[model samples]
Target chain A: MKRRTFLITTTAALAAASIPVARYYSNGKKNYPPLIMPEELGNFCEEKVIREIGDQYRKQVPQESEKAKLQQILLTDDAGKLTAVSDNAAIAALLDKKIQDDFNSSRILVLSGWVISVTEARQCALFSLT
Target chain B: MHIDARQLDNQSVIEGDICIIGAGAAGISMALDLENSAHKVILLEGGGMEYDDRVQELYNGKLTGHPYYPMKASRLHYFGGSTGHWGGMCSTFDEIDFEKRDWVENSGWPITLKDISPFYPKAHEILDLGAFEWGAEYWVKQNNALKLLPLDDNIIWSKMWHFSPPTRFGTKYKDAVVNAKNIHLYTYANVVDIVATDNVASIKQVTIKNYAGKEHTVKAKKFVLACCSIQTSRLLLASNKQAPHGLGNDNDLVGRYFMEHAELKTGEMWLNHTEPLSFYLMGDKTKVRAELAISPQKQKELGILNATVSLMPLAMSKNTIPSIKIWSQDDPRKALDTFHKYSNLDKRNYIQKLFSKGFYQSYGLYTRSEQLPNPDSRVVLSEEKDELGVPRANLHWALSPIDKKTVYTINKVLGQQIGAARLGRVKLYDFLLNDDPQLPDYTSGGWHHMGTTRMHEDPKKGVVDANCRIHGIDNLYVAGSSCYTTGGAVNPTLTLVAISLRLSDHLKKTM
Candidate 1:
């Protein structure tokens, strides 16, 4: 997408959201998407992760400080199909696949004209990796 | 699967204008720069695209100096080089980073920061971070709008930052590299030796062998070694065919001056702050998303040197679920629709909020300024050669006692200021003193590695020049954090990318 078009579309779509809309180019008056952040692999990476993770559990709850059970989940998918799994990779794979399929369905309609949904599953397609 | 030179029956010999050893960051960047240029570039990798178990095993060893992601942290054997899994946090070295600090030893770069400044933009554009431009002074947005707030230090401590698409070189740049016309980046051809002239000054050819027992000899007009620090120095130490000590170790400077970011376990918090920080958004780089330190007042008050902050989020920070906030429907931020996307919003705020209310971490680690350089902390050559005749690197990472003292002092002073401002409470762990049976917090390890083949203007003190060229060798070069004279408190990826682009232009002129 052209830079101008992307900004326009993103702004128009998100203009109705509850959050405050940011201006992309201050003087230029282009609107930016809102920032509604959660936990991201990239975020922990910026802060010394081990320190951050340890800090979240260790400092806040002195009672359970002795035992902090932090779990990391990593999942990989090839062409919308799961491929590999790990303890900590990225959160996209950790979130509900139903949501991913929902987002992707909208994405297909938005960009390439393809219609695929989570319910369009075939018994033969769900085979485990050999 | 190690190959012997005698099996060269079906092997190929190639000649080129540039022969790059250790196909890592600088090597691939050079090849990309010279993709269609006149320079005949040949990149040799000890580890190849087809994963070799042995090489992978060696790379899995503890990342002694720097902290990269755990699962993704593999000293890559693939085409894109170690950049395959790199988290693209790009920044350039400052002039102060080049100057020898009284606090640091075996320190100082041969080149000035100006030499690498020009290349930062191209790297930034390539990385896709237009919103957060590098080197450009911070800007503020007047009509700002976003779900997240600035990293107000009153609410959050270490704030968040950003980079472009955060390039994972291997995956992002792989297509252009594999199809390049002028660049021949052979995957498994690991260079064993830099066949130099009898005088031992000029590198003539490199002998390489792959896991399939195949041998290849490559010669070029210019050569570059851009492997990670330990390997670059190790390759020098192992190429003892001409120089008994190693390739560039006449003064034993090849593997010396290893630097990594050492982290301190700042004491934990019992209560998570109710409010989140906005400093990470305050910078002009991205949206005015958050704010932390680095303002004029704070810089002077804390004698603030260069550093970057990133606020981390906790599980409670993500409790934007409609179910959790069902009781508080009137809450301003209780929109269920926005809850899921909160992770994609300004993460720095989430961290500040999480720490404010219920969640907090025990350790607040500061990847402090480049610890004083010490020659004793060096990368040595291992007697054993891998599947490729390339010798392995044995990392002997030891730090100066003063390094620990600095961390302690930073914690004490910074913590006091934080508490004085009522930002957060501070705890100084007794890990450095006798073992603390109660609190086992400690200062240890570097996730960011740097300064092996350092950049220097003078040949006597450094290996590479301001342009990142080997002083003695005409066409040879080095790049990445390994070329950093000092590892600043911030991440090194941006600096490496910036310098690499600058070096590419330098090579362009010479080519």
Candidate 2:
């Protein structure tokens, strides 16, 4: 994706989510995609996983240490339908598939070039901004 | 005088004031220092001046845990020892590596880095490396063009490594050892068994054998096992006369606590800066290069293992993974040779090429980290015996949970530091981001074998004492990486030679 187009689309999604937008770069910015913090994505993934599993998560995984156990279920497609994906694309798609797989239904859509949960789209419009 | 042990009589009994087994870096350094002394030193080497297949087979054994190099070919069984193929990247172990960190179990050396600091300069000279200096500040003073990364010193600082002409001990010290008046250099004298007294309190004599079928008994006032880590422990465990479990097997700590610098390519860093980070890049003619090491303060605060990260441009790392493929070779030396054959790229120029071609600047982040001491990751006697009639050393290298945690935490720490500084971003490999019991396939051993016969103040916990003397044996001492209480991320050759020099000084005082 082109840098200027990606930034404009991502900025629009962030604006919709009520996140503040700013002049990200001054003078000459490298034409590369802006980097995202891993922990930020990790936190989003963890919360989504907990909410998806609901009461069963607390009953099965007693401690925060056991949260890693959820990774096997979240990262892999149980139905074996996760299309082969590149490393970077896999990040966004896996989370989307995880939410769909847990509910056993397709409840996600692409908005402003971002794949986000349809139910949470208005609240987390920046979900797939990267 | 230099003697070939094959010419000795079948029942010959040779005696010396001090017997140093193995003619590797440790043994040669000790012998060289003791040259012209009043004490008569007998230096025994397993193979001839060159590599020998029959003698190399003595190192053959089974590997059970975590895929490892083939036993026989992992180490060279020759006069100069493993130094024959050493890369000569030398650095001293940090003080933190020796301190008693409560977080690191089986940690703390009985002696501190200060105890061996005095001898490091002499070791550097022995290794034929440059001036007695470490850290980036010292090198920057020498070469004004060098620039350090603007990283904070408190969080991460440069750990300097000085390269050697990589003196091959066997070739470099061959003439000196042969010509030394007080030292007797004997090739093809493989130690078969160690015999101690009835109580096994002291070593009485060691039997040496040759593939030519000649046998000889060497009685000495004191014995130093200067063999590499694996064989040193293997010889100790094979001798079961007085102690059914081996000479120093009373506490079963002889072959335990084995360690290797767990070198892994774990992640990548993307920096926005257009200017080259040339200081981080090692120059062709430069003797010193720096890698990013977490500060000692950070180690205690974070409760993590000591590790250093080196960055490589992504374009230059295309063949890095193929070198690790050498691990599966039946003959590890051949595998090593294959890796060396493919590693002829000029890394610095390659990175420069990427920059000039307008390729995005991304680095392949890699680490050389310390392994927490684990008794289970050890060497034991295999069912098969060598031609010398001693059981081969079977190595089962197991990584502790702490080992995995260390790798993950350090990478995380690096990511945080880079992010906080706004110096681009780090994308950690999925394995590090997740809690997986199994390590990635790209994970490879550093070929640095250490901690088999670790030194300690207490006999129960360690095979050797602070003075490098075996626990119960009054006359037996161990030299080389085998006596290392902890294998620091730094290469072991420099420290191993320093300890050997220290042991030699102690022997001089004792005699």
Candidate 3:
């Protein structure tokens, strides 16, 4: 279905389901907009999830220097910093830790609320920074 | 005397000074208050003292919005009504729930918080709860270790809630109602129709039927519909023999304005310091649990709805990433089982690998927010009929944009509040923060059905007036959450019981 038809169908479904579709359909006339947009908000959520994953990964690795090195590499030029187009493979190549080989660029990920390819996540640092 | 309507003659006529339909929390509470009074009371319970599959089929209906619990499994049809399976989390509605807030559509009640404040203490007794205290100071004083998160009180504060021993009215007050000299308790009395006068201004009698081949007519000086929200509206809408539009439905408002306590897991909170947060935890001996609550002033300032958040440790929270998919299962119980199994496996793995590293326990922020009352969200009669021939209640449980906005704003506000306090960070769930927001699979309700027969002074705006009397009707009243004009973000039992007691007082004066 087209985007407009999709919204109309979804709104009709919501009306039937007892959800408040009017809030969105009203186009901010009565409903207030959030202080932050979806992607911005999702970035924070993604960062949190990735940080937790990193923390768990750190526990298994048992190397404090490796953890610090990985964090530092994510911010440096070698890690494809500020590149408009970057992928997981490019960033992983710069990591000093041998576990860098574990990087899987083609993997699909659901970060925060955004569904994206692993390569797309490299652009946002798993929603930490863009 | 306890009489079985099924044992009565086919056309038996029963008379009383006051007749209360549905012996649930509200009906039983009202009857208990009127015991040994000058006037005689008749209490009608559709089912027997226990659950009956045949009677429960009356609640079977279709769901049209977010997936809800099966209608049949959602509420019990026996004598105690829903209190039979209630979790007994009790708290009073905030003062704001009664006020006509500019932000909330169709908000405000004809009565103020103070109007029902006097009866809350009595209701506490009826519900077998602790004191009437819902303040932070009262609970904090009881347990010194209970320190609220050091957040700005003006923005957010601790809202205390007391748990009930979960008094099942069927088991708790059955004997008292059964033996009351002036109170007549009738079982198996399914009211098929409410017979109103030609003017449709007063209910002359109610006709009830039973599978035992007995039919009866109950007449009273006054009548109260204390059935649960959906059933109350169903009876009013189905009783169209006298009024073409059904009794108390001249405004087409009887079944409108349905509301629920929209419970959602909004985000995760990671405390930087391990304070144990013992006060917020459900203790074996403690009577209350505190949730981070947005103050009414903040709500008005921000144009948000009343909402509260409880913290659940990640180990126990059912919303973990690996298991949240289980919630999509059609059967809520099966979904819960799948979640538990997946969560348990995840928990065991994390404990094995991360326990040695002192991994900080993360907590999930469970949000229970108020739904802005919407006329479009309502209860309507379905084409399906039950064994007793009553049309099943087809529920259109819609959420308003304001309702979704409430969740998003509160989570966002909480994130900001936590960051500002330097306490910890809050990461809102992805779905809530997404542009095309979809309700997460885990979203459900507190099973608090309300606002079907909203109380208002104007007949056009409500099904019942300030006195709980159906507008333009001389003696018909509603005595449950169905009479609520606006539902706050708390369980409805305490406030609803208080409302029922207030109605009892009104009847005592008028009868």
Candidate 4:
């Protein structure tokens, strides 16, 4: 087979493996490059201890404006089908929801408003002026 | 002179007690080991000092790999070698890394971690770290500012990375090494070939050349190839006068098993949850190391053989780009320089805020997976030779499917756990995500390379033996990651240093 054709087929197979059954081939719209490449992520996540969520995007900010930006990083959701986060309110609310969810998950926490993470002791924290 | 000296026209006339080739990490380390030993040592480095302008001319706008000016010392020449510009983050190999795994094909080391424990302390000393310690205890005394992840069940954990104080080997150890009585480090000296007397059984003498087109040779009782992985293997493959192929390419394993950490472009990761921020285990956390941890047992359960994931802060919560923040925030290139200018508390406070304000500079966990030995990833002899006329090595590397899978699993687990624990939101990132394993991710090729010319109980599987001696060859040994059979979840430098120190002990014992 031609290299290009082979690549196209393999790419399709990979895309299928990554996205959940709920996701589908778009009507030829722009696709976000899958951020996570194929290197083994880590086997630890497979432990029954932590549950897996099919829908990667979970929004806590019931707000509309920030939800678009949250989806921008969290999911590609049918591309043009979903409204993009175009407003500052959406970005702020979306950031807040994401932070709150991680915080609830214990991925984020506060002490004197100074954030702390459980991943690596010395590193891994987002800095912001609230 | 400690420098290997002999007429190029008559290699048979060369003489020295010890002849070392490929003056990179391993070579230099061993050279440092033998500095004042009883024997006279001759060192032949393949590359010249201070970045050969002539060789730089050859790179001549041919920017092909990783987009880094392409004209870099993927192997450096000269006195101090590649350590000339290294971001020194050091860690030792875990004991589990030495065990043979039924899961990973050809995954096991001839030597166990215990065998090298004695040398770990010394290796740390050479790298100038505080001591042989890791995990939580190290953090407690420092300050419990950072939140620690629980990765190990029994042992407490703390992770500390050291900056080299801009450790340039030339400036750091130049006077001592060059002026030492027993050590002679030659500049502009390059090893072009390694030939044997009869049956590729022994390397009789090595041919050397300088940029001036002057060729020379050196002979010794024992020869240790210390150059980095590519050059060491390249020299071996290029020397095939008596052998059908080359010196140690008998099993066609001279340049096989090429491995490097494949860095992925993690696209925008959104956290439906807020990412945790920590400052407890900042600089002085060496007291209580257990507070910090990585999920290892979780890794074993997941069928992920060799990989790791660290939470890297994106430019901002909204902008998920990993590296851009360094640039977007007040010009990162000048940030370090700026940090040096001000020693005041205000400057310190400003730097801290800068560090906190929307960008974090760090590495994800090393996918310390083994580079499955593949003949395809082999480094070949390039037509463009170094200044020494020795054939330059053209590396042809392509990540196989297995490589992609290994990367995918590592990120999934780490991202999920970090996200599950609410550490931060991780955007999925596989090494092949961008379809460019060789893309300009700041973390690829991780100068932490290992595996080529690996060690094995059998000669067929490896170029060197347990003691790093090349099997069948009476007095040949290698020092560096090239001798590593199974590289574990730690820096190869510390482990390779451990192995070299063992080589150093063996050399002293035998001598």
Top candidate on lDDT is: 2
- lDDT string for model 2 (B1-511, tens) is 8999998778888889999999999999999999988999999999999888778888889988877778877788889998877767789999998988999999989999999999999999999888887868887877777778766678788888887877899889999999889999888999999999998889999999998999899999999999988999999998898889998878999899989888877776656554355566544455778888988887888787888887755444322452345456666456555545434432334334434432235566778888889899999998887777888889998777767777766666676565445455455666764557656656778778999899889989999999999998999999999998889878899999999999999999998
**CAPRI-style quality class for the chain A–B interface of candidate 2:** incorrect
**Interface RMSD (Å) of model 4?**
19.7
Model 4, residue B60: C-alpha shift (Å): 9.4
Which numbered prediction scores highest in TM-score against the true structure?
A: 2
lDDT digits (tens) for residues A1-130 of candidate 4: 1211222233233333332211112323232222211001111122111111111111222231233333444332224333234554443443444444543454632211123222111111110100
Give TM-score, chain B, model 1.
Answer: 0.76
Off by over 4 Å in 2: A1-130, B336-340, B343-351, B358-360
Superposed by TM-score, candidate 1 places the C-alpha of residue B311 at a distance from the truth, in angstroms, of 3.7
Reference contacts preserved by each model: 0.00, 0.00, 0.03, 0.00
Q: Which docking class does model 4 fall in?
A: incorrect
Predict model 4's lDDT versus the native: 0.51
Query: Once all C-alphas are superposed, what RMSD does model 4 give against the true structure?
Result: 13.7
Clashes of each: 64, 0, 8, 86
The DockQ values of the predictions, listed in order, are 0.01, 0.03, 0.04, 0.03
Best-matching candidate per DockQ: 3
* Tens-digit per-residue lDDT, B1-511, candidate 1: 1222334454678788877776565666667887888777777666655444555544432324322223123355555665554444445454666665544555566566676667766666666656543322242233333223222343223333454444556666667777787776666666667777888667788777665677778888777777767667766778887789877666667877777655543322211133323233222134223222233233224443333332322232122221212222222222222332333334433433333433232222233444656676677766665545565566666566655554444444443344333333333434533333221213344346677777666666666778777666665677677777777666676677677777667777876
In candidate 3, list every pair of residues with a backbone clash: A17-B64, A17-B65, A18-B397, A18-B398, A18-B399, A19-B398, A19-B399, A20-B399
- Model 4 DockQ vs. reference: 0.03
Candidate 3 displacement at residue A63 in angstroms: 38
Candidate 3 lDDT, tens digit per residue, B1-511?
A: 8998888878999999999999999999999999979989999999998877777777778878755666776778889998876767788888888999998888889999999999999999998887777887887887788887777788788888888877888999999999999989999999989999998889999999888978899999999999889999999999999899889999999889988877877777655544457677653355788888888888998898899988755433432332223234434345335434433222333332332221233566778898888898899998888888888888888777677778877766666566445455566666785665445545687788999999998988998999899999999999989999988988899999999999999999987
- How far residue B88's Cα lies from its native spot in candidate 2, in Å, is 0.8
Q: After superposing candidate 1, which stretches have Cα over 4 Å from the reference?
A: A1-130, B1-9, B54-74, B132-160, B268-273, B281-310, B313-368, B419-427, B430-446, B458-460
1 or 3, greater by TM-score: 3
